[model samples]
Target chain A: SQQGEEDPQALSIQEGENATMNCSYKTSINNLQWYRQNSGRGLVHLILIRSNEREKHSGRLRVTLDTSKKSSSLLITASRAADTASYFCASGNKAAGNKLTFGGGTRVLVKP
Target chain B: GAGVSQSPSNKVTEKGKDVELRCDPISGHTALYWYRQSLGQGLEFLIYFQGNSAPDKSGLPSDRFSAERTGGSVSTLTIQRTQQEDSAVYLCASSLVASGSLNTGELFFGEGSRLTVL
Candidate 1:
């Protein structure tokens, strides 16, 4: 598993259900961020959780980071069909010149 | 444009040919970056630019790949002797500031330019 790599590459859930995705990294990070991409489009920023923070939320989305475990997770509550897209996690580490490295991403399919 | 704009949305070229992709970042944004995504692959960082000068290009795959930003606004990514392996969606993003304590995680991205090398 590479740094900023997410598991459950593909997921399917019925509308109104909650969905969760996981990401793990090898190195210490200054912050972790989530992103969403519609088909054939550029990514859109979703949320950011700093190393010092354990959990953060934005509307229907929630993000948690555990530095001790070198992992992070993204949760989407009350998922709708519009939530179908690819989700990626990115790691930002100061030791690495503060550039972001993106993960492979999870392909989410929210069925109506 | 109200958002980041990219030119030549799609380009198809023969192998060994040179190609240029352009990106116009949002107005008043001072930081820009270039990234590429191969099919089924994650976004790969190509370079980072602050103002008109690039400070980090270690992610560029080879010498054949080069990028330059001018006037602190528009940027051009040039690929020399393009190869089939270079086929990908080239994406450009901009932020209000460079990566640091004050940096926000949000990045405004342009619809990527899809490049196909035959």
Candidate 2:
């Protein structure tokens, strides 16, 4: 089974609206990271939240992690059409030799 | 290097043929990873190499899939007797020791190699 899974496989929103996606994992992790992919090419790292940290913020992006629930959420505020992309969550742990296990991803479409 | 580089941006091969994909990680990066992404699907782990340590091959799907890193820099992923199911975008990434407390778990990726098996 995949170690990480994302909820709300697809989402649609207009510019200026907020978008949120959640991720769940089955194992303990040292850190959880989020990435965005455009047009199915390379991925761009977005944010990283340590397992010990509950929330993190970077500009308009907010991420929250709940270890007890083994879940995490990414919130995009005032989303623009440029924000449209596939977002993926990855779980990293020492047991995996520092390699990350990625989720299927959530496809987000921000309409102008 | 400016970033991770993948060769053969696109490849097409018939069933039972063999193909090889190449990846050159950012200079000095110790960690390199390979992932496969099928259409409308998430990235699937394939392999990982860190410096001189033995690569972690747990994510490889079958015996026909193999990868080797030379001099801890460039890597090659080979698939023998390719099948249609092997068709996907093969992505390569590199990072600086992504695990430890001091390291941030960020991966820099290269434009993937699109592989098609017919």
Candidate 3:
């Protein structure tokens, strides 16, 4: 079974708008990492938030994790056309052998 | 020089034939993983290897699929008697550690090998 499930399968917004995607997981996770993938390309690691951390920021990206709700959200502020890609959230469980269980992913389209 | 690498970026083979995909993890990285992604779908975990520990093959779809990591660095995934349903992008990733304690378990992914089983 997949551990993570991302909401809003697809999203389209203007270049400067803010885009947010949510992910929910079933089991307790050691950490959650976000990645970006261009069409037909390998995933690029973006950010990782440990279970002990509540929020993390890098560049224009902000990720918030709420273990109480078993959910996490990735926020891309002032989105750019370059940010148009598929965003995935992978949850890592200690018992899962460090293998990341990826979500279905959220495809974001930034219209310039 | 610091990323995972996969071979045969694309492959096409007839059904019932066998295909092999290779992956080279980053230097000194002890953790490796394999995944399959069908069109418009999420990635499915296949297997995992961490150092000398026993591999975790619980995610393999069937007995037809198997993977091996040599010297704790390079790995290969093999599928026998392939079916059309097996046609998908096979991805490989490696991490610095098997536990999330260090490195946050961020995996370095390879450009997946797209397999087309006709």
Candidate 4:
């Protein structure tokens, strides 16, 4: 079964604008990781935030995790056309042997 | 291979035919995983292999789907009597660790094999 759901199933914005996608999961997670896919190709690992971590940033990407609310959010600042892709959040806990359970994903479109 | 490599970047076969997809994970990686993604849909976990043993095969959709990893290296996923619904991109990924913590929460993924069952 899928573990999480990304909100705003789809998002569209002009270049240079910011894009934010939210994800919510059910069970407690030891860590959460984000991924990006372009043109139905292989997924690229983006950033990971552990349960104890509240927020993490890599490049223009910022991920915030709130274990109390069982949710996380991905914020992309200075969106570019190249940033258009599907974003997914995967949850991994020790009980699951680090096997990830992924979410529905949020599709973002950056129009130039 | 420097990264996970999957064979037959694309495949098309008749409905009743069986298809085999191969995945060669990065050298020395202890974990390998397979996932299926329908058009515009989320990834559906198919199977996971740690070393040569699959502690979790629960994600496989049906009896038609089966996979095996040999010598802790290459893995193959076979689908028998392929159905149109089986058409999707099959992705293979690998990580350095089997369980516990990941130094870098990263999984190297192959370009994936696009399978179309006509």
The candidates' DockQ values read: 0.60, 0.68, 0.69, 0.61
Candidate 4: where are CA atoms >4 Å away?
B99-103
List the candidates' TM-scores in order. Answer: 0.95, 0.97, 0.97, 0.96
lDDT of 1 by residue, A1-112 (tens): 5568998899999999999999999898888889999999989999988888999999999999999999999999999999999999988777877677789999999999
Residue B32 miss distance in model 1 (angstroms): 1.0
Candidate 2 lDDT over residue span A1-112, tens digit each: 5888998999999999999999999988999999999995799999999998999999999999999999999999999999999999999988767889899999999999
Error of 4 at B68 (Å): 0.5
Question: Could you arrange the candidates by DockQ from highest to lowest?
Answer: 3, 2, 4, 1
Cα lDDT of model 4 by residue, B28-63, tens digit: 998899999999999898888887564589899999
Worst 10 residues of 4 chain B by lDDT: B97-106
Q: What is candidate 1's CAPRI-style docking category based on DockQ?
A: medium
Residue A51 error for model 2, in Å? Answer: 1.0
Query: CAPRI verdict on model 2?
Result: medium
Mark the 10 consecutive residues where model 1 chain B has the least summed lDDT: B97-106
